[model samples]
Target: MKRKSTLSRSTTETEISLSLNLDGSGIAQINTGVGFFDHMLTLFTKHGKFDLTIDAHGDEADNHHAIEDIGILLGKAFYDALGDKAGINRYAFQFTPMDEALCRTCVDISGRSYLVFDVPLTREFIGDFETEMLEEFFIAFTSNSKMTLHVASLYGKNNHHIVEGIFKSLGRTLKDACSIAAGNTEIPSTKGIIE
Candidate 1:
C-alpha cells in the first residue's frame, strides 16, 4: 500500500492544506508567505525523498500561527501515513554538514511525544522566519505525531547554514526511521505494538 495523506485545517489564526507521500521522488510545492521557510521545506522534502505540497494563509503581521499550524498538520499527515508503524525501522539518526555548520538529528517513532532541541542560534531571525519558532514547530510536530526527536547543532557560526543543516539532517533521519526494515513486516516494538 502506498503511504500518503492529505490534511487541512482552518481557524481564525490560519487556514492550510497539505498532502504528503512518504514514498515519492522528492517533489515539494509549498507556500506559507515565508520565503525562508518555503526554501527549507523544499530542501527537506528533496532530501527525504518525499512528495509534499502545502498552501497556508495566516495573519500577515506574524508567522507564528502559520508555522505552528503547518507543524501540526504535517505531523498528523505523518502519523496518518504511517498507519500502524509496521515493519518500519522506527529509529534513525543523521549528521549533516552544510558549509561550516554541523547538525545532528535523531528520531524514534516510538508513539511517545518528546523533543530535545539544542541548536545554537546565531541570530533572532533568518529572513522573515524567526529562528526561535523552530523549536515551537518541532514541539508541535512531535506532540501530534507521537514521536521522539532530538536535534542539536554541534557548531556553526552562520545561522542560515546551521538551520539549513538541521532541516536537512532531520529530513534524512525521518526518512530512515519511516522506511521498512529489511524484510521484516512485524511491528518494530518488542511489546508487539506501538502505542
Candidate 2:
C-alpha cells in the first residue's frame, strides 16, 4: 500500500503544490523561495526518510505566506496519507543530541491536534528565517495533521544547533510513529478508531 497526497492552494497572494509519501527512501525536492527554510524542510524529509516534493510560489514580497502554507499543506498530506491509521505504531518519541545541543520530540497520531514547543533560541534569526517562525510552522502542522507533537530542547546554547537538533529529532520521532508494526492489524487504539 503506497500512500500519497497532493495539495494545492491559490489565493490572491500565493500558489503552492505539495506531494508526499509516508513510506519512501529519503528523497526530497523542495523550492519554497526562502533558502534557509527550504534547507530545513529538506533536512526534515531526508532525516525522516520520506519522499517529499514541494513546488511553491508565493508573494516574493512576503515569505510568511509560503512558509505557513507549506506547513499547512504538508500537515494535511500526512493526515491524508495515514488513512485509517491501521497497523501503525501511532506514537513515538526520540532524544537526539547534536554537538552540545540535546533535543527531544514526542508525537502521537491520536486524531487530536496539540503542540508544545519549548525551544528557546539565543538569536532572533537563523539566516533569513526568523526563529519565531518555527513555532508557527509546528502549530500549522499539528493543527492540520490532528496529532499531538511536543518538541523541547533540553540543552543548547547555539540557536542553529538547537533548531537543527529539534528538527532531526522530530523527523526520527515521526518516522517511528508512522511505521507499520508487524503482527498488528488493528488501529493502535482501544476506541477502534482514531477520529
Candidate 3:
C-alpha cells in the first residue's frame, strides 16, 4: 500500500492545501508567496525523495501566517500518511552541509511532539522569509505530526546556508525514519503501541 495523504486547512489568516507521497521519487510543486520558503520546501521534497504539493495563500503583508499554516497542513499530511507506523525504522539522523554551514537533524516518530531547534540564525530575515519563523514552522509541524524533531546548526556564517542545510538534513532524516524495515511487522517501540 502506498503511503499518501492530502490535507487542507483554512483560517482567517491563511488557506493551504498540501499533499504528500511518502514512497515516491522527489517531485514538488510549492507556492506560498514566499520565494525562499518555496525554495526550501522544494529542496525538502527533493532531498527526502517524497512527492509533495503545496498551494497556500495568506496575508501577504505579514507572510507569517502563510508559512505557519503550510507547516501545520504538511505535518497533518505526514501523520495521516504514516497510519499506524508499522515496520517503520522510526528514528533517523542526518547531517547536511552547504558551503560553511553544517546542520544536523534528527527525527523520531514516537507519537510524541517535541522540538529542539538550536540554529543560531541571528538575522531578522533571509530574503522575504523571517529567520525566526523557521522555529515557528517546525514547532507547528512537530506538534501536529506528533513527532520529536531536533535541528541544530553546529556552525555557520551565512544564515541562508545554515537554514538550507537544516531543511535538507531534516528531509533526509524523515526519509530514513519513515522507511519500512524489511521483515518487521511490529511497531518500533517496546510498549507495543506507538502514539
Candidate 4:
C-alpha cells in the first residue's frame, strides 16, 4: 500500500500545506519563513527517510501558530495514512548525537496520546524560533496523531545541537515504529485494536 498523506490547515493565524510519504527516500522541500525551523524539519525528514513537503505562511512575528498547526496537520496525516495498524512495528526508540549533544526518543503508536519532553536547551531562542515552541508542537502532534512520545536530552550544551538531536531521534524512532513487518497480518496490540 502507498503510505502517504497530503493535508492543508488554515486559520486566521496561519495557513499550511503539508505532504508526507512514509515509505519514500529522504527528500524534503520545506519553507516556514523561520529558517531555523525549516532546517530542523529538513533534518527530521532526512533522518526519517521520509519524503515531506511543507509550505507555510503565518504571522511572521510570532511563529508559534504555524509551528503548532503544522504539527497538528502532520500528526493527523499520519493517522489518516496509516489506515490500520496491521503488521507494523508499532514501537521504536532511538539515540542520536549531534556534536556534544545526546538525545533519545521513544514512540509508540498507541491510541492514547501522551508526550513527555525533557530536552532542555541553553538558549531561549534560535534565530526566529523560540525553544518553548517545540513543546507546543509536540503536544499538538501527539494529541492529533494519538501516539505516545517521550524525549529526553541525555547531555547537551548548545541549543542547536540539543534540539537537532531531539528532532533527528524523533524522526528515526517514528520511521521505525511505523515500518510494516513483511507478511505479518496481525496488529501489534493485544487488545485487537489500537483505539
* Model 3 stretches astray by more than 4 angstroms: none
Candidate 4: deviation at residue 159, Å? 0.7
Model 4 agreement with the true structure over 5-112: per-residue lDDT tens digits: 999998888989999999989899999878999999999999999999999999865888888998899899888777788888999999999999899999999988
Point out the worst 10-residue segment of candidate 2 by lDDT. Answer: 59-68
lDDT score of residue 194 within candidate 1: 89
Q: List where candidate 1 sits over 4 angstroms from the true fold.
A: none
Candidate 2 at residue 182, lDDT?
72
In candidate 2, position 38 carries an lDDT of: 83
Leading candidate by lDDT:
1
Q: Write the per-residue lDDT of candidate 3 for residues 54-87, one digit (tens) a residue.
A: 9999975688899888888888999999998999
Better of 1 and 4 by lDDT: 1
User: Order of all candidates by lDDT, from best down to worst?
Assistant: 1, 3, 4, 2
lDDT tens per residue, model 1, 1-195: 779999999999999999999998899999988999999999999999999999999987689999999999999999999998899999999999999989999999999999999987969899999988899999999999999999999998999999999999988999999998668789988898987
- Lowest-scoring 10 consecutive residues by lDDT in candidate 4? 119-128
What lDDT would each prediction earn against the true structure?
0.93, 0.88, 0.92, 0.90
- Residue lDDT tens for model 2, 27-84: 9999988788888888888889889999889886767778788889899999999999
User: 73 in model 3: Cα distance from truth in Å?
Assistant: 0.7
Clashing pairs in 3: none
